[model samples]
Target: MTRIKNILSVIPLFLIAVLQAQEVEFGEISKEELLEEKYELDPDAEAAVLYRSQNTYLQSSGGGARLITEVHERIKLYSKNGFGHATETIHLYKGKSARETVGKIKAFTYNLVNDKVVKSELDKDQIFENEYSYSYDQVKFTMPNVKEGSVIEFMYRINSPFIWNIDEFRFQRDIPIKRLEAELRTPEGFNFKQTHKGFIFFTPSTEKKMDNRLGMDVVVTRFDLKDIPALKAESYVDNIDNYRSGALFELVSVDIPGTVYKSYSQSWGDVAKTIGSSSDYKNELDKTRSFKNELDPLLQGKTNQLEILKLLFKYVKEQITWNGVDGKSFQNGIKTTLKEKKGNVADINLLLVAMLRYAGIKANPVILSTKDNAIPLFPTLDRLNYVIAHATINGKDYYMDATEEFSDVNLLPIRDYNWGGLLVDNPNKVWKHIGRIAPKKADNMHLLKVVVGADGTIEGSYQSRLTHHSAYQFRERYKEKEEDEFLNDLERKLSNIEISGYEVKNAAGYEGNVTESFTYEMENGADIINDKIYFYPLAFLRKEENPFKLEKREYPIDYGFPFQDRYMVEITLPEGYVVESLPKNIVMNLPDNLGKYKYVIRHMGNKIQLSTIFDINSEIISAVNYLDLKEYYNQVIIKGLEQVVLAKAANGRDTGSTGNK
Candidate 1:
């Protein structure tokens, strides 16, 4: 009986082994994986990560230590959406006093053909490097013979001279990561601090192994993460990288017995003090005598802090042009930039700080990470990317970054609106938020009127009013693009319409409402069948698409700023016609009065007027409110598509009956 029972269990065990064969393995492309058409776990994914590995540690060289991180990845492309681009790129950072570089790389592409594996190795000549600036460079290589059902793999190592530059290991990406492993080993003289972001939880396997590197006793730490899902991006969010699943290891302190002891990753106050003490920043603050002469003429005997501040701010903005880099330390002194009139972000903004101090407005330099850059999650002077001036007017702090030519005083360029900034004060240091004051509002208003003829052809007029952030965007677009190009875009968008002409108000100013008016004619925007005509009441003023498509969202839905969009349209009926069907008007409201939507349709003697008011009074909505926001917009889109139907009277002629639609 016992032998029989053992034999029964053997059959089940055999089936388990066969099922596990579908799992991933590095450098081993099974026929099942190559033949597979889709990943059952995520049907929408075009490509998937089979495996990823990272091993970062300190390698001793010539009596000094350099940080080395080795990396390997295996990816499978399932469709053309994933196969079009298969280039591998690595970013290398270099500093004045420290250096970092990438080592030789090995990569290959594999495809299954006629039940056999075919291999294509990446050529040595295909590798190229691009140096972005004096501080950074990138190396790139494209995989060879990549196609759908291809398995591509690459491995490389990077060496860095700065210990604090230890990078974070991201477990999640645009595609799912099946298995990710990372290991770190350092000498006893080094210590580190770790941070974890995103929703996934990973329990690391820890073990101590004896090793000797850099002429010192070292212990290795290993971490292995498994089955991390993809962190997909969604609309209405700022820098999804801020909330991705990852682990960061930063060097906290270095203690070399009887030789040197240095500390990093300190308290916020210490971080500010270190920045204030740097000669690059401290010296720029002290040199007020140099720019005082230039400010005297611009100041014009102004006594109010706000007046002096505006004069100096306007002077720097008009006189200098940014070289399109974000930094806190100047490459050249402010005095030189004032004369040369062309400088990087630091050179342009630091001069503003110097001038403000000369005028005795009690201004200081504050560093901010733009929306494109990673949010500064910790108090470290090294990671801050951009600098702006901070002033106290009537005991209120106003932060300004003049890197953008279209910037208007406290109404900063949109990118500078990241959450927090580090304020560098001599003895008293603090973290300043991007908005200590109330947040700004967004306004976009449109008025459209059209008249439909007997045969369903239409003539129309459109006028738009923009304010605040909306005004800034309009001013920027008209300044950048040609007038003909802008009007051509409108003609193409309005669907079966010809733009007769248009005019713009405040084409070159920052401080007022921008107005735009245009005239047009529509060919088939309204449909006519026999003696009946049909049209959506709003015409071109309707919302085109639903911005929120994801069934589920992981982050807060941020509109960036509070906004209100108002659209109104009036449609005049053709001769001898009356409304037969009209969509029921609807009203929707978000909880807590965060948002409201209203649609109204009124039938006048000869015209039908429709108006929709959609407004959100706050900049951000919590995840708990996402479902509501998604449903609200979906209803708006549905209502915007509702049609207005008209029927001809007994005396009317069927002119459109013979015309082809």
Candidate 2:
């Protein structure tokens, strides 16, 4: 972000030294890399990628040519933490009819012995493959004799049946890459579109060559980068993948002589039309006309559209359990989902839309990619990874996803609240865009009535309300654990303080707010010296440390959604006690009206009243405001940890307790 280091010029010098330093073949050990003490690029890196290359081409197999990629990488470990480099895990996408397969993997870890280099070859028996999900598997292997100062190298080839979907490449990782290269060679028939992302920019060299075997001229694209800094993960980004330097290649079209000029890439409108017309999708909703026998009984002739929407949402969410897999299309259709009471995201959400249509409410399915998945860079069907339902209620489009049990109407999982959703109709087979809904006053509010005892123990009645994302988070955990277990966890977070009178409101419903009230008795939570007492008013709710540790940030700060938090405390004092010291009321804000923070402290009657508000009005902050945001949270943290002091009347001398509780 500051200046591009002239790594291109510097790398050639190393390239010259590397040429004669030692052998740098696939199996040959490079003594210079193994004995390397510190990586000049990043001295703190536990490991470094010495050299890595991915060469992809179309190869003939099974009477046709398929996409095949050969990958080779060499790594040098600086410490034990780098041992993970020796273990390789390749994710293979295997469906019912198509798959990506790995071929001929050779791995070796080299180390210096008493007089010569020792090689520990990888055993084929050590390689194991297992299904990670319904449509994905991982082939895992760990090299032998991996340790500190070891140079590990491995090479493998992968052949994918889906030729149009080329593998994306990353130029950066968590560790520095001393030298990185990726080359792609394809026949002239294919026209591919390449897109790049991240703060770093790169250009690839291209050349053409004739292939006699294929009888076509092939284009070779080579990307070479040096001293590529590691992409460290920071707080507040939607996904680190969004900021990592990478490239994506998608086939746009293929025009072979004597063959048809087929288009491999389609517009989003076409993708929506194609999906809406699919038998597995549009037809799924059309078949629900037969569900009237079951739907009529539940609706009971209720004509209220809002009530019907709630009933349908509750029925689908409560009756059918999510299979925990999200997808764009239904696997078993809506009928099977209703009968079996279990299905994937598409099945459950589609069923909701069908029942809604049967009830005379106009509804459709909206497909979008989740936050954790790749950012949808282009208009392609492959970019869509999830589906939810949208309905017009009183001239307003309300989005809903029943995959989550507690998800209410118009409330979706945080992951589903990404960029935007594509609204597609089944009956009409048309598509439109649905904008994202913003959250308002979704604060984690805390109100506490506390009194410090003479024996240094603090007692309080704690009440808190969690709204929006905070509510969903707490309700999710509450559902996962039993009552006592949940209480224990809450106490553990509050420093093992005893909590009673605990009551949870709206735990079973999705609307309004989640209310949690409890009485707490905390020992050693206050300090007493002679006639003075000092304690933190927040109890265990204080933020112990700042979340932003980086001096500078290069990516946007994403809070997923805008949020607010307020803590109001009313600490009652003893009969003769008076306020000895109180934190000064302070306000901190971001420039240009981005965000603001306020800490107001005052004494009301016989109690010290404190009100603190931290609001992030914007959903996201660009990298330019990162340092300001970081400092804002730091001030909030400091104020959250500030202490409140009280002194007994009698000889009202200025004596105070020192040291933190």
Candidate 3:
């Protein structure tokens, strides 16, 4: 009896060991619990799981969805015999019971290009397994040769009963799979190279962890070696249909007939359950509210509009920080953003809208996802990503995105003002167009009084003004630098001049227009030689040298917005000197009537006056007018480099008269 009991125990232990060995030998699913859980899901829901789904909607149009299916792909390779060639075929079937539609397959091609497969005369038959046979009558192909790397890129749509863009196709024991095999074709010693830019396989054998472009976790199935050449991989469609196909086929009994994508989407509710509002979020919203309330009265006051704008911008940028995700716009709902303080694009913009509304101002929240970040909204409310506020002041609409740092209250960052925007207003569902590109305006002028001694020495005091967009740029770029450092740097750039005293007028702060005036001293670089003192205008400070540095741009060039710039300089000539030549006044008008420039030079008695004005009427000049605009700017920059020549009186013309004397 003792020996029999021991034998029984040994038998059970041996069975357990065998089972354990099988589980580890190959990546297998052995959980009966998992199987039961899967079976319990709705069959129609299972079918929907296999479909590809996309959302494209907007608040105006409600929202929309798209389902994709049966993607067929064939790749052909032409190669020298030694180089080897291959083709891969993928026929994905999606929809309710998509797997049930996969019919009988006698033969399938693997690692063999169309030419090779045809040459081998492999049977393109259907393999019947569970409730379906895999069929591949359709032939779509990508033929990439060494010569056409940049010119050819191919994509195909396939109906997959499984998940869309799944990392791997898994199969388990259940349905009879006749030939479970895999074939790989690559350069003699080539290995797979992992890349984030393109698709790759993640298999049970993969050991490397990686993060995808979307910041999602993933793994690498294979690594590439330098010596490797082209690569091709194929696996006989897994026929162990019981788990893979059976799971897919079972969907036929259910009413929902979609793809695995639909199934996953349906599970979004479950995901939402895992995320609940936290107390931290509540606290952040309260702080944002308190901050807004504190600033309300100040903003409402009849302060200088520009000063108010600047202050408002500073306050908003400082008050709230972005959580660094897109889609925070109003479409996601502002209440959620107000509650979270750190919402996506829509959320933050909504908060801006709420603040403006609370301040008793007419503000509309404009909705749009940045170009690269979200898909273009289809017919419905979809793909909206970010938001900005549209405020109306004195019958003028101003677009503002406080989320962008350094942007003034009414100014929209170039990134936020793309092509079109939907302004959210209850009575009006109109799509408002963002104006043309902003114009860049910058101008600086210096006037100096100089005394030239008999020995050709000189000294002078100078006054100057740097105005318009140029002023704003200089300030922003140097905001971090000390005031003395900034002025010192300017003095250094005008090094030929000796500085006596300097004052930055209208530089206390930036108010819509940046205007600065300063005083300085300088020595003349030229002296009278036989009364013909030759002098050249300093071109280093020339306003037109290189205003537009970009050689070419895919998008429009923008200054801060509509802009105007003016610079005037006056220089008191020496006592015995008379102006010889002066730069001619030049004007450039944009081809499409976009803008104009005025260059003026005036000579009055012993004084030289130089004034320049650049004005851009509007932003969105049509692309059709690019050629004319380009030509116009070319002329302006060229003429801006022209010099003003000066000549002095003859040696005896003014006897014993020092320029200062």
Candidate 4:
């Protein structure tokens, strides 16, 4: 009898395996194949299916045979008649042994009040293993309660396609979702094309998917087959929403279920305790008992505190590496990270704070969410995502992000230096503001002494000095490549100005301001029309390379850091030719002194000096300032490319002039 029972179990197991394989129709596919397919499902299609039905495990992963937890979504889509759909789902996770005892569950219902999600009520259930005969448990969910409206609205569970350094789960339906436009964010040199409805296929699509920028998997669809005539399509960055909600409208998942589950789900505290409970954690703790003296070398027997502090800041940033993302398991704090040589943002920065404290230096951990995260700090623990160390030396405080490799002791990378950062004073303590980004000032001085021939050919050696932010950005561009490649790339990016010969100086060391002097020979492509040669004056740096490409946006445009840009170009005209028209000298003060722009042109004999300066006084500005900023940029661009006409000298007598000359 036992042998017969074993054979029966084997048959069901084999059949179950077969079903699992068949259900996986939407596995990872090549870009070519993905593009070929007309309709594709989301990566979480498996989860989506579970949410499609009522009495199904909608939000629990612990029950394989029996769904234990679920979220019920109900909506009343009413124009005149009540045509509303209600959906309930139960999510279940089955353990390694399809045992009912191992199952866990939870449930919730979205509540909408006057077209807004007022609250979510979690469901309570009794332990029921009788839901499924095969070692099963269950999660129960009911439909969300909502009022009648011209439009249906609610929030739905969504998993992020991009697994940044940290995982992001979205439940946005604050507004209606229309023509959804989501651009795949990626680093430079990489390009991608859309595949299927919501998926974008990345270039060089590799079989070995390890997740770089090889494109992220996404799922988007309009569930209501009957489209509303008034509803139009729209797009939003970093979020999904409904576009048209006539009067009283709130986005509520009517037919969709929840997207969370339990299957041996590990909690942060649990993971930390388990690890910290072991000898490994103890051994690691012992290793980093105290931070070594990082400032001794800088002192060099002088005992200068300022220099020592600087050295200490530099050492911590260089020696400690930020893992960028917080580990799901690392709750024991910085001690665990110190011994491992690698830790999450919180771990590393907190460790740095500990180190400073150990070294008798005053340092505090500043908690902040990176620009991408954009969580508001309202005294809630949820707002704090990452940490950076702030230290005061000689009565001046400097922000230090130890995780970043390119950041100096006082300077934060533009990427992390967003709007505002909150400095958390340890656990359960008052918060302090670490402030926003620093004012990056770039003073560019270009002195070109060219011996122009009578043929209108400008031959000169140009020395360009870039200071502050400009130099920092310049160093970052060719940081990965060799010297020759860097120079070639730099020249190419500058402009269409043809350089017959060139040289680069002060390009390597990134401590501060960089000065590059290059020998250049180029004809200022000026067309002489009726003795008036119009020089476009696109300049080495033109406005066509404008970076702000934002559209009508809902969120605020954050520059993060303030910056000042100064451009000075001195060009020596040919001995025979004379300057007929130089760009007008213009100076304008920005609104509220947030920034300033100045353009000055001075002609000293045959040489003309053109200077342009734009300075941004503040980093954190309101969105209302965007229009002014945009307008300022527009003017700067027009002025930068403004032409300077040079008339050729009548060659002893009057004759037909050549456009080339």
The TM-score values for the models, in the order shown, are: 0.88, 0.90, 0.47, 0.56
lDDT of 4: 0.44
Whose lDDT is greatest here?
2
| Per-residue C-alpha lDDT of model 2 across residues 104-183, encoded as one tens digit per residue | 89999889887468889899999999977655789999989988889889999898767556768778887889888788
Report residue 611 deviation for candidate 3 (angstroms): 2.0
Across 220-288, the per-residue lDDT of candidate 1 in tens digits comes to: 556666667777788888778877888776667666576456665477666666677789676667777
User: Mind giving the per-residue lDDT tens digits that candidate 4 earns over 142-169?
Assistant: 4344334311222223221111111111
For candidate 3, give the lDDT: 0.39
Cα TM-score of candidate 2: 0.90
Give the higher-TM-score candidate: 2 or 3.
2
CA RMSD of all predictions: 10.3, 7.2, 21.5, 18.0
Question: Using TM-score as the measure, what is the rank order of every candidate, best first?
Answer: 2, 1, 4, 3
- In angstroms, the error of model 3 at 625 is 4.9
Pick out the ten consecutive residues of candidate 2 with the lowest summed lDDT. 11-20
In angstroms, the error of model 1 at 110 is 1.7
Candidates' lDDT values, in order?
Answer: 0.74, 0.78, 0.39, 0.44
Strongest candidate by TM-score: 2
Residue pairs with backbone atoms closer than 3 Å in model 1 (clashes): none
TM-score between candidate 4 and the true structure: 0.56
The model with the greater TM-score, 2 or 4, is: 2
Stretches of candidate 3 off by over 4 Å are 1-318, 321-327, 330-348, 369-384, 393-398, 426-471, 483-512, 520-531, 543-560, 618-634, 637-641, 651-661
Candidate 3 per-residue C-alpha lDDT over 454-569 given as tens digits, one digit per residue, 9 for 90 to 100:
34454555555555545555557557679777777776776545554555554445545444444444455555566565443433344443433333322234333455555555
